[model samples]
Target: MTASSPTKQQDTNHFDPSAPPPFKVADIRAAIPDHCWIKNPYRSLSYVLRDILVILSLTFIAVVFKTSLWLWPVYWVAQGTMFWAVFVLGHDCGHGSFSDNPNLNSIMGHILHSSILVPFHGWRISHRTHHQNHGHVENDESWVPLSEKTYTALDAPTKLLRFKVPLPLFAYPLYLWKRSPGKSGSHFNPYSDMFAPNERRYIVTSTLCWTLMVANLIYLSTVIGPTLLFKLYIVPYLIFVMWLDFVTYLHHHGHEQKLPWYRGKEWSYLRGGLTTVDRDYGIFNNINHDIGTHVIHHLFPQIPHYRLVEATNAAKPVLGKYYREPKKSGPIPLHLIDNLVRSIKQDHYVSDAGDIVYYQTDYRMVGKKVE
Candidate 1:
């Protein structure tokens, strides 16, 4: 029952992730330097401006080389990564890490997210839910595993699409429209169960912003011709979705060691937050604004993205074995592709019974029989 006590089904390993951490959240907080917690508006704004300039530059280059087949694919990958970077900045705003000013956060969050066709407030609120309930089997929002019963109930086509590799990479758009399987509510719908009565107004505003962005895209597509628009915007947008899904999923799943999900008395904010894993994205460690430094961010989201590395390093001694050191990447993160594919094939669901559970492989999905 205590933080140091082992659970009923204890792993004989030296460290048990399911056991509550020996340190408290305050312990980690005290470890991080005070400056890491400070949010500077000017510095945050510079990132937004830089991302906007890069996006515009990419767009300009793509337009100039519109006729070149080779450049089109290159443009999609670069532009999409930039779009994901923009979303990370907006995500900081959602967590109040962008600055201390609410108005400034809202203004920037809307502009960045809307341009990428995301409902800013809707996603912010839902993401807040995800943070608050992370590692809770029933409550956590993004990439939470399905319960065994729920997984078995799913039809073959649904199972294949959900568990399949490339298909799952393209799931972000569908998730925005309808959240992960076994959950309901559109991120854009104010009346959906996801929001409270007072929160509906914010949802309505973001949904309208999202709609306006879509309308603007339609108008531009007509003006520039659909094919050109598809090459420039649509391809990049899809690629951005892939990056979003890929990064988000990897943060919670695909650890070499399995992570625990909690229910009932086993769940605590600190315990759930500890389940999050940091990643090394090699060159992208900076390009995507250090989102790969995620464990500390989940534990203390108010820490600016610029300072996550410092915060994590400071907290590491206290974190001890709980901190999973990320595998180093080469010039590119091609190594992560293996993690993604292996996790999809293996981490299909959790047991219905335990207060604490790890993902159970559905052997059938991987062409194996339960031994």
Candidate 2:
């Protein structure tokens, strides 16, 4: 079928599709493996507290203590890793994946995601929607795709900058302001996309709370000599943004693995996720909170990150060839290449059905052309 054709059928054989899976709801009540569920609330609390302590230990040394003069590398790397863990906790809170209680989730989510400068409920709502529509180009809340015409409309110069320069140069800074208040997207408003602007009460309240927190930190920075704030807080937060862009980009944007689309309301969860790749990143898996198991996460987000691997292992038989894990070990340059390739392809769903295919036509005359 051509790009604009209204065909409702697709080449199912061209992609690995599965029955809607991970079956988290069905799996939730199943006998969880020992130590999997964290039945003890104290243990859950300790895990969170431990992450905090590690963060503080590293950050204090780097910013305040400054004692072990040779410890700067250890300080920065350790603090950055802990921040990643903290982000995982915040993510769990948003999913209510860390605890059985909603109130606890809300409070923890505010503390974690807000401290990192994201609007808690606003992102939670979008991220939750992302889980629901993970693979659907138009519907996936976060990594939603762009159309070919839309992709092609970019002039050559703009494309060059987007791939060759801007992605590395200004992407992280852009994410901060983009996710901040009153930007192109909803300004910290969860209901903004789905409801009337007047319905964003929770958003406004939480945003004010975050603003106050930032203000208090800024004030403390003066007494602490601004050095602590910049050394510990500001630099780490920027690193978090860098991680965020990398994680989100390589997950779905540019993998050559899978592409599936449906017309109108015919969308199926199985086909939407076929393109996910199993990135072989070694042990950095824990650092990214096993976001590598993105396929299972999208299938059943309620499954906590800690339990995701087990869930994937158990369901792989059922998911069969459809299963995908993000290729974890690809170097930054490989990732950059992969991303550029995906960005310009059929980045979004097309009206017609065919294979999950990618092709680029170069019109510049480099050699004799075949008729």
Candidate 3:
């Protein structure tokens, strides 16, 4: 019933693919204390304000200390970390866990998400899709692996692109623009296949806000000069992309075992949600509002971020053998880099057709695809 350690052998791993988990969703939900479910608007907004204040403070210090080129590295890390925290708060809004009022969540979601160049409604809808289909092969949004047939069908360039590090790490912006492989439609486009007709207006509103943010940056560049703007925003924005890609990719992809992807009747909301692994960001557990408590967040997105840890502790007994213990981490999660590299090297694709499937590596395709 204990969580498995990182060093455990893959064959000895606890998850049994042949049978469905014994526990039911309601059982786990009932295990959590009632108080953990309450979402306090004031408490949520306090996090928003805290991240904004720190972000602005970092920017001000970097701008005034511009002559000290040496400090730019420190500024970039601090600012980028704060940017990720802001995104997490906005993420809470998208899930409707920030407050009881829909209007306030919308307004705050737009302000926080758009500032970071995310199209709020666009991302919200797709993210909701991700949550719904997390363990399904074809249906999962974001970081689902390719099937062997799909991988072989990809052009040489794309096959290569899929496994490379820095390139994949920077894929967030491109994903927002076009989405993942085998998926069509843009997060920026309301008419894209991912959205419904009624949802188009929300997508357009978010897109315009993103446009305005771009325009503001353009104007700022004209006044402050490109160098300062680059130092202040562009560099940090790329870092934010790295942070986003790093945290999310590991959540579902880099476990010791090749995590199963479900299909057809085998899939269920609780099963899909359990496929996600919790992570430890050490001190960053609070700085980013406990986002690394991902297993519980996936199980119950309605629980506010601040309450995820409490809910997670309460649910662990119920989760028992089902929970995948995260590898412990330092201030930064450097340990995961090994998991990431190993996955990229070996976990290339799953079988094309199966109710349950594990990743399959193409030995010939491995070295050839990473260049």
- Top TM-score prediction, candidate number: 1
- Report the lDDT of model 3 for residue 297: 91
Segments of candidate 1 deviating more than 4 angstroms: 1-13, 369-371
Q: How far is 112's C-alpha from truth in model 2 (Å)?
A: 0.9
Which numbered prediction scores highest in lDDT against the true structure?
1
Candidate 2 per-residue lDDT, tens place, 108-140, comes to 888887777776776676677667666664566
lDDT measured at residue 285 in model 3 versus the true structure, 0 to 100 = 82
Candidate 3 Cα misplacement greater than 4 A, ranges: 1-10, 13-18, 368-371
- RMSD of candidates 1 onward, in order: 2.7, 5.9, 3.6
Question: Model 2 off-target regions past 4 Å?
Answer: 1-41, 64-74, 152-162, 165-184, 189-191, 194-199, 254-258, 261-266, 278-280, 325-371
Local distance difference test scores for all models: 0.90, 0.57, 0.85
How many clashing residue pairs are found in candidate 3? 0
Per-residue lDDT over 40-87 for candidate 1, one digit per residue giving the tens place of the 0 to 100 score: 999999998898899899999999988888999899999999999999
CA shift of 147, model 3, Å: 1.6
Q: Least lDDT summed over 10 consecutive residues: which range in candidate 1?
A: 1-10
- Model 3, 113-136: lDDT tens digits are 999999999999999999888888
Minimal lDDT window, size 10, model 3? 1-10
